[model samples]
Target: MTDSTAPRGGKRERLVTSAGERLHRKGVAATTLADIAQAADVPVGNVYYYFKTKDDLVRAVLEAQVDQVEAMLASFETLPQPVDRLKALVRRWDEMRDVIARYGCPFGTLASELDRRDDGLDLEAAGPIRRILEWAEIQIRQLGQPDARELAITLFAGVQGGALLAGALRDPNLMSGQVRHLERWIDTVAASSTQS
Candidate 1:
């Protein structure tokens, strides 16, 4: 018998975690609400109780992903050195490999899926991602140029490209290479901005 409060603490978390994993592994198109319900060991109706629809579940999963990254970035921001923060970001990303391997990056996969559609669901799904990029822009600006926002967008694009390739090639190493390339570019840009 489950504890009465288990639904809010354990069961709800399990459903979201399972849904995120499924979304990462198979993407939005292939994953079904029933699949998440089964993976989470929650009844189908219970899953619906937590999430009104499949899209709602997906949005929540994406929001969770964004929140994790945002927390990492926030911690890095407190470190006092811009370059160190950048390096910390990379390290945090490296730590995400297992999650990436299991369910892909929710932001990358969901953004790709939503690109082709113009529905409210797609727009709603993109909110967290947009906020992330916005925050990243602020960080990038601190590192150098007035147009740091654009640089943040570029970095986000590169990461997504790397993730997409990782899924397609079935090799996380591809993501490593892409991130290395991004690091180099960031270093050069940051250095140049400091000199100017």
Candidate 2:
């Protein structure tokens, strides 16, 4: 087991961080504890000390992703204008176009893969997406959209679609184009809100 007194950000942190990255790049089924152990530079046997089972580690990864989603949404809350905040969200993805082109959106890809399974873990993996939808809905509602929930789904769907195409086609431009379109769409929504 990991030492309880181990310094902060020790082996356990490394394992979780490495596993998250590997699990994103490699599908959950394809990622073995051995792979994570090697990536984290922890001994294969020691992996079991920290994570009793693969499922345990997977849950940890899901929790980390959820935390990241919460942080991203909280950061947007700091912006003064709802439209600008939404634009910044789009721009964040645009900035990651190269990475998305290579690996797709980390959360999107993982959720898509896990969603195909009948196992209950899929629901756990999807928590981050659900949180994101809720956050987006709040942002859209702030723009005075009556169908905020539906619009939020559409907005995120566009982003996910862009990531899928960008990864499949190995084209960052596709992601960038989607980001630009989203920015324009946000502007249109904001303008419509003011006129009504």
lDDT (Cα, tens digit) per residue for candidate 2, span 72-181: 88898889988888888878889999999998998899888888877788788789889988888888899998988998898889999999999999999999999999
Q: Whole-model lDDT for model 2 versus the true structure?
A: 0.87
List ranges where model 2 is wrong by over 4 Å: 1-9, 194-196
**What TM-score, to 2 decimals, does candidate 2 have?**
0.93
lDDT of 1 by residue, 1-196 (tens): 7775345459778888998888877878898888998999988887777777887787778778777767866787787856566656655545565566545676767776866777676666676678768777776778777888888888877777777667666677777877788788878778878535
Candidate 1 Cα deviation (angstroms), residue 31 = 1.5
lDDT score for residue 169 of model 1? 69
Q: How does each model score on TM-score?
A: 0.82, 0.93
Computed on alpha carbons, the lDDT of every model, listed in order, comes to 0.73, 0.87
What TM-score number comes out for model 1? Answer: 0.82
